[model samples]
Target: MAWNLDSQRPIYAQIIERVQYDIVSGHYNPGDKLPSVRELACEASVNPNTMQKALSELEQSGLVYSQRTTGRFITKDTSCIRKIREELAKQQVLEMIRRMKQLGFTKEETLTLMDKIYEEATYEHTIGV
Candidate 1:
């Protein structure tokens, strides 16, 4: 999880976003145990307190749950995971659309790009590329 701390957002917020991305991308699947706070802090080269804050936010959002003695685990709700995935997908698509608009891409050009991307994705899957 290489993070760009230079972004305008706070470090903890970036950490939270990265973790959420991991969850949505299936890197941390439902019910999977996450690294300990200290471990994750070291891995991310961030302060333990920052990592804890990020984890706390995730727990509050119900994306992760803690066991009294076991540790934090990714939520076991498939629907929650799907919802997160959809929400993130929508956000990314919106951002791309906004950028394309700013760059003077017409609606037709945007649709053409989308179709090209879809075709490439399908072709890659079919050819195992």
Candidate 2:
């Protein structure tokens, strides 16, 4: 995970978002064991306690779970992961629209431009660009 902390939010919350993005983007697979708290702390350059707090929140969100005498793993619930992925995608799209509106684009213009860009990207992907 590329950890970047912003002044706008808590470090642990940023950590949680990074982990969630990793899981949804397949950087971390379902049932995969995450790095130890100390390891993740080193990776994110934060204190161990902060990483632990972020992991605890992930557990509460059903994105991860810890086993006795073992360690934490990404949840095996594919449905939950899929739901989260869709939610994040929608958030991205809405943000894009919001920015375009602030730049004076109408709703139809924003969506049409989005569709055109997606089609071009899809074509490139299909051709192994």
Candidate 3:
């Protein structure tokens, strides 16, 4: 998948978010080995140094850990993964609500629209649309 990075935010920060999403979404399973920093940099079209910085930050957060000679691996702690997943979801929801409010949507109206859109999306998925 493309990293789809933008200039609006720091590249390393974007990389962190991408990696976190991959972990939480099961693109990388618990205890799964991650690609090398060079490999990840190539994949994200970023500099190795930038990828290193991002991965280092992830390590600090206990999301990924390095094993001396081996490369980095995703944390095997399911609870930690769940916490990160929930944090990510909350951030997304908060952003969505902020945007909706800016567009003049009341909280209730936004909820209603969200429900409608979700139903439509679920139906589309069910029908293989």
What TM-score number comes out for model 1? Answer: 0.85
Candidate rank order under TM-score: 3, 2, 1
For each candidate in the order shown, give its overall lDDT on alpha carbons: 0.89, 0.90, 0.93
- Best-fitting candidate, scored by TM-score: 3
Alpha-carbon lDDT of model 2: 0.90
Top candidate (lDDT): 3
RMSD per prediction, one decimal? 2.7, 2.5, 2.3
- Residue 80, model 1, lDDT: 85
Runs off by more than 4 Å, candidate 3: 126-129
Candidate 2 to truth, TM = 0.88
Clashing pairs in 2: none
Model 1 alpha-carbon drift over 4 Å, by segment: 1-4, 120-129
* Model 2: ten consecutive residues of lowest lDDT: 120-129
